[model samples]
Target: MSFIGIDLGTSSLKAILVDGQQRVVADTARALTVHRPQPLWSEQEPGDWVAAALGALHDLRDAAPSAFRLCRGIGLSGQMHGAVLLDEADRPLRPCILWNDGRASAECAALEAAEPASRAITGNIAMPGFTAPKLLWVRRHEPALFRRIRKVLLPKAYLHLVLTGEAIEEMSDASGTLWLDVGSRDWSQRMLAATGLDRSQMPALVEGSQPAGRMRADLARELGFDSPPLFAGGAGDNAAGAVGLGAVAAGASFLSLGTSGVLWRTTAGFEPRADRAVHAFCHALPGLWHQMSVHLSAAASLNWWANVTGHTEAELLAALGETVTAPSPVLFTPYLSGERTPHNDPQMRGGFARLGHETGRNAMTQAVLEGVAFAFRDGKAALESAGGPIMEAVVIGGGARSGLWLSILASVLDMRLHRYPQTETGAAFGAARLARLACTGENSGEICTQPLGSPEIFNPQRDLVAAYRERYDDWQSAAEFSRALQ
Candidate 1:
């Protein structure tokens, strides 16, 4: 049998077909738009996700008809922490408040004020990106709409509802909402009440590898499936990617350089260090938890630089030429969308420092790349400070495609980095693995722990590491100076 995995990302919907042998048969993605009605606000129509998802599935079906027809289960992964409020009829009440939206800062403070034990309970600092604060934002600003909210769902859970007619959520995604009790792995009544919500408005929780429900008969028919496909609860993108990369075991970790940068490490038990702003949450699997340190921009800083410089990413990366003779004098702080790890400051902005007559496009580009690497180092340091070890990390995401960036990251982090054969397919492939586990009742460890195809390892250069250590110190000083100006 074949399994289908769907990743509902912030900028696109990606679907992949994987057979029982764990080989990807076909994959497709459809672009999605984020609606920004106001500054620091990010929203998306839930209906657009559903449409994009279906469209991507259609593309997959066309590409691999037999594999698509043989699909027995479906799993979902998505951007976490989005608040998708629903009415009594299960229709979305408004555009979802995305994980990156910063409109709920005041609400975050209010939540902490109302629930003093919130950090202990949720294993996280109250951030505007979390669902609880977004709900509080609605309750305070759009009280009428808040009154109409009958249920709350994350982005992927909304798709689950659309496909299965079930209001269900999985642990990994729900953990980011500040509603789930991270230690207990269930929704917290106290946290919900603090946000002016209750159990009734929450979706029934399930493990990511468990079956939430079967696909709706109509959806099955529309998609040309022979029978109703089993739906696995799946996970948030990072957790799902972890499963895909076989990072479920304790100390197993990976670095993702997508729009945001994340350094994630799996652990055997609940570990919360809210003081560091390090995220402590349940993993997709039962009895497993993970800690993540996040930087708001990684590859995004590169993308922005490319856009502003009128150069393609390829052109800019090509300029690196495989060796680092010296560090760029120009230091950059990559706080383009504010920051999370260590400093949880949403008002922070990023820019280049120490430009001179000698500074050119190449120097500026190198600074941008090195700056992102430095920010990720800060995340790694925070994770380590929180007692999470960093033996090694599997690298994945769009930025992982750049060898120069990976070299810089490895050197700056001063840790070995491994690249899987299919780095870009991490989350979707993981969703597929979850589908297999849910459908076949197979052991999650066995199903999820396939060797990444002869992984390529990136080891740090000692000289470069030493140089980056000094550069990192300077970068921290530059960051402090920037914050002082704010």
Candidate 2:
């Protein structure tokens, strides 16, 4: 038997086919773009996601035709907090408002004022990045569009509708909407009311491992599958990545340096530390919760720097070798797309400080690498200060491919980092694992083991750790000045 996993990322749509042995048979991706019609605003046409997923599935089917025919189940994982409003006919009302968009800053405050217990109910701060704030923004700025809304869905839920003709959302993704009573693992009527919504507008919620819906027979045949596949309730990107890394049990943890950076730790129950800007939400698994301190830019910073310098990410890293001898001469703020976690200020922008005449491309590149590491250090401190101490965490994502960046991040956070062979496809792998559990009814704990390999460990060096600490302190002061500019 085989299963499929789809990860709808900010930059692309990825699909992976895995056999019963948990081996990846074939994986493919289709590029996606984010549109910014105005500053601090980001949107995407929902139709693009469907087109990309269809195209990617066909590519995967062509790569492994036999395995594709035996597909037993499918799972989904996606970027969280994207607001996809639907009309009465189940069509998108407008372009979906994305998680990174900061245009809802005023609405975020208004939301909190409208519902004073928002932090307690949702276990999250009223940040512009969350789903409820975006809806509020639409209500005030696009009142006519708001009037036609019949249902609301996160990005993956919208995909679910296309795949199964069912309106469903899983817990981990719903937790980011600010309409869920995360402690209860269900929608909160009072929370929904604050945004001029009700439970009827929300999708049916399920745990990530459960079967939410089955594939439509007509669509299944059209896509070349001999039989319809079951659809598992998948997870938000970070939670799914954690499941992929076997970080489901309490205290198990990992850090993801994807387009965005996330410091994720699984917890035993609802633990709200919203005051620290730490995200407390449900884990992909039942009865488990997680806390994440996120930075909006991580690998994205390197991508930005690479684009500016006319070099591939690999080329830039090859120039730096495996480690740097000292702290960067310059400090970079890494807020190219604004800031989240601890600051929660969407208006804040990033830049470099203390550049010298001697600074060259190498020094600037090193600074960019160090800047993301410093931001991770900030998030680590926030999570640690809230009683979750930093020890070691498995690291995944495209950024984990950079040995030099890993070395810097290890020393900056003074924590051990582990990487497995399956780092790059962790989210999709986790989603595939969920499909397996749903199809076979296996124990998730047993099914979600570390991928087959001895992990490459990145340990902190005493000298480098001390050096990074001093530089990180200075960077903190500089970050405040940047935040003040907002």
Best by TM-score: 2
* Predicted candidate 2 versus true structure: per-residue lDDT over 1-486, tens digit per residue: 999999999999999999989999999999999999999998999999999999989998999999998899999999999999999999999999999999999998899999999999999998999999999999999999999999999998999899999999999999999999999999999889999999999999999999988988899999889899999999999988988889988898898989999999899999989888999999988999999999999999999999988999888888877778899889999997787888898988889899888888888889999999999888988898777587999999989988788889999989999989969899999999998988889999999988878999999988999999899888988899898886
Error (Å) of candidate 1 at residue 401 is 0.6
Relative to the unseen true structure, what is the C-alpha lDDT of residue 337 in candidate 2, on a scale of 0 to 100?
Answer: 74
TM-score, structure 1 vs. true = 0.98
Model 1 lDDT tens row, 214-242: 99999899999989999998999999999
Range of the 10 consecutive residues with the lowest summed lDDT in candidate 1? 444-453
Off by over 4 Å in 2: none
TM-score (all chains, Cα) for each model: 0.98, 0.99
Identify the leading candidate in terms of lDDT: 2
Model 2, global lDDT: 0.92
